[model samples]
Target: MEIATYILVPFILFALTGLKVMNEYERGVRFRLGNYSGVVNPGLRYIIPVIDTMQKVDLRVKAVDVPSQDAMTKDNVSVNVNAVLYYKISDAKNAIIEVEDFKFAVSQLAQTTMRDIVGETTLDRLLSERESVSLRIKELVDKASDPWGIKVNSVELKDILLPSDMKRVIAKEAEAEREKRAVIIKAEGETIASVNLSKAAKTLAGNKGALHLRTLQTLNDIASDQNNTIVLALPLEILESFRGKNK
Candidate 1:
C-alpha cells in the first residue's frame, strides 16, 4: 500500500502541474524536445513537465493601424498617407516557425507596400480611386505574407494629407473647369437661339403680309404697357386719298 501511495501521489502532482487551458479563440503550437509537434485545440491539454512546450496563438482577427508615411506621387506631389489593415493567422505552426514576430513582420510589409503603391500612382488617381488603391495594397501584402501564415482581409486608406499649396491649386483648377463648362453651355444656347431666329425671319420675308401683321403685333404688345403710348403711321397712298376727299 505504501509503494502504491508514493507512485500515485507523484503521478497526480505531475499531471496537475502539466494542465493547460486554452480558450475557444486560442490554438496551441506544441513542441516536444525542441521539435515541432502538431497543434493542440482548445480546452484542457497536457504537456510533459520539462519535455514539452506550447505557445498560445489567438485565432481572432487583428486590426493594425499603419502610421502616416511620407511619399511622392507619380506626378511629383508630396503627401502623407495612413491606413488600417485587417489580418489573421491562417496557419499557427508556420506563423511560429517561419517568422520571428509575425505581427511586426506583417506591419513592416504593409508599410513598404503602401509606399511603393503610392509612388507608382498619380495624385489624381490616388485621390479619386482610393478604393482601388487600398485593394491593391491588400493584394500585395496578402501575397507577400502568405508564407508567414498571414491572411490580409482588407486595407482602408484613412487619410491622405496633401500640401497646402496643392489644395489651393486643385480648388482653382476645379473652379476654372466649372466656369469653362458654363461658358460653353451659354454659347451653345445663344447659337441655337440665333439659328431659330434666322429661320423665322426667312419665313416671314417669304410672305408680304406677314411683316405687316408682325408689326401690328409688336405695336399691340407695346400698347399693353400702361407706361408706354404707341403712335400710328399712315401710308402715303391712304393720306393722298383723304386729302382728295377733303378738296
Candidate 2:
C-alpha cells in the first residue's frame, strides 16, 4: 500500500503541473527549452513540467491616457494638452516580441508627436481645426505603433490648457466679433425694413385712396390706444383750404 501510494502521489503532482487553462480572450505562447513554440489555443493545454513555459497575452482593446504635456504653438504660444488613445494588440506575437513595452513606447511616441504637431500649428488653427489635429496625431501614432503590431484605433484631445491671459484675450475677441455681427445684422434688418416700406409706399401712391385708408388706419390705431387728445390732417381739410385761397 505504501509503494502504490508513493507512485500515485508523483502521478498526481505531474498531472497537476502540466495543466494550464486559457480564457476565451487570451492566447498562450509556449516556450520549450527557451525556444519558440507555437501558440496554444483556449481551454486545457498541456506542457512538460520544468521544460516548457507559457505566456498569456490578452487580445483586447486598451485605452491609454497620455499625461498632459507642454507644447509651443507655431505662433510661439505655450500650452499644455492631454489626450486619450484607443488601441488594440493585433498581432500578439509582434506585440510581445517587437517592443520591450508596447504601451510605454507608444506613449512616448505620442508625446513626441503631440509636441511636433503643436509646433507646426498656430493656436487659432489648433482650436478651430481640432479634428485635423486629431487625425494627424492618430496617423503619426499609428505609424509609429504599427511595427509593434498595435493598432491605434483613434486619438482624441482630452483637454487643452491655455494661459489665463490668452483665454481673456480670446474671450474679448469673441465678444467683439459677436458685437460686430449683431451690428451688421441690425443694419441689414433696417435696410430690409426700409426697402419694404418703400415698396408699400409705391403701391399706396398708385392708388390715392389707399393712402387715405392707410392714414385712417393710423388714426384708428392711435384711437385704440385710449389717448386723451388726438391730432389728424385729412386730405379734404387741406383741399378745402386750397379752394378757399383760390376763390
Candidate 3:
C-alpha cells in the first residue's frame, strides 16, 4: 500500500507539472530532446519535464513600427523614410525551428528591404507613388522571410522627411507651375475676348445701321447708371454725310 501511494502521488505530480495551457490565439512548438516534434494548437498541452520543451508563438497579427532610416534616392537626394509593418506567424513549427527570433528577423528584414527599395526609387516616385513603394517593400520582406514562417500582411510608409532646402525648392517649383498655368489660362481668355470683339466689329461694319444702333445701346446702358455723367458723341457716319453734302 505504501509503494502504491508513493508511485501514484509522483505520477499525479508529474502529470500536473507537464501540463501547459495556451490561449486561443497561441500555438506551441514542441521539441523532444533537441529534436523537432510537432506544433500543438490552443488548449491544454502536455510535454515531459526534462526531455520535452515547448516555445509559444502568438498567431495574432503584430504591428512593428520601423524607425526612420537615412536613405538616398536614385536621384541622389537624401531622405529619411519610416514605415509600419504588419505580420504574423503562419507556421509555428517552422517559426521555432527555422529562425532564432522570428519577430526580430522580420523587423530587420523589413528595414533592409525598405532601404534597398528606397535607394532604387526616385524622390518624385517615392513621394508620389508611396503606396506602390510600400507594397513592394511588403512583397520583398514577405518573400525573404517566408522561410522563417513569417507572413507579412502589409507595409505602410508613415513618413518621408526631406531636407529643409529641398522642401523650399519643391514649394517654389509648385508655385511656379501654378503661376504658369494661370498665365496660360488668362492668355487664352484674352485671346477669345479679342476674337469675339473683332467678329462683332466686322458684323457692325458690314451692316449699314448696326454701328449706330450699337452705339445707342452702349449709351443707354451707361445712362441706366445715373451716378455717371456720360459724354455722348455724334456717329462718324453722320459726320461723313454732312461732309458729302458740303462737297
Q: RMSD for each model, in Å, please?
A: 5.6, 2.6, 3.2
Off by over 4 Å in 2: 226-229, 236-247
- lDDT string, candidate 1, 151-174, tens digits: 999999999999999999999999
The CA lDDT of each predicted structure is 0.93, 0.90, 0.92
Instruction: Give Cα distance to truth, residue 138, candidate 2, Å.
Output: 1.1
Query: What TM-score would each prediction reach against the true structure?
Result: 0.77, 0.90, 0.83
212, model 3: CA deviation in Å?
A: 7.7
Clashing pairs for model 2 are none
**Stronger candidate by lDDT (2 vs 3):** 3
Q: Pick the candidate with the highest lDDT.
A: 1
Q: How accurate is candidate 2 locally (lDDT)?
A: 0.90
* Model 2: how far residue 210 lies from native, Å: 2.1
Q: Residue 220 of model 2: what lDDT?
A: 84
Cα-based lDDT at residue 129, candidate 1 = 100
Model 2 worst lDDT run, 10 consecutive residues? 229-238
TM match of model 2 to true structure? 0.90
Model 3, position 46, has a per-residue lDDT of: 86
Span of ten consecutive residues with least summed lDDT in model 1: 228-237
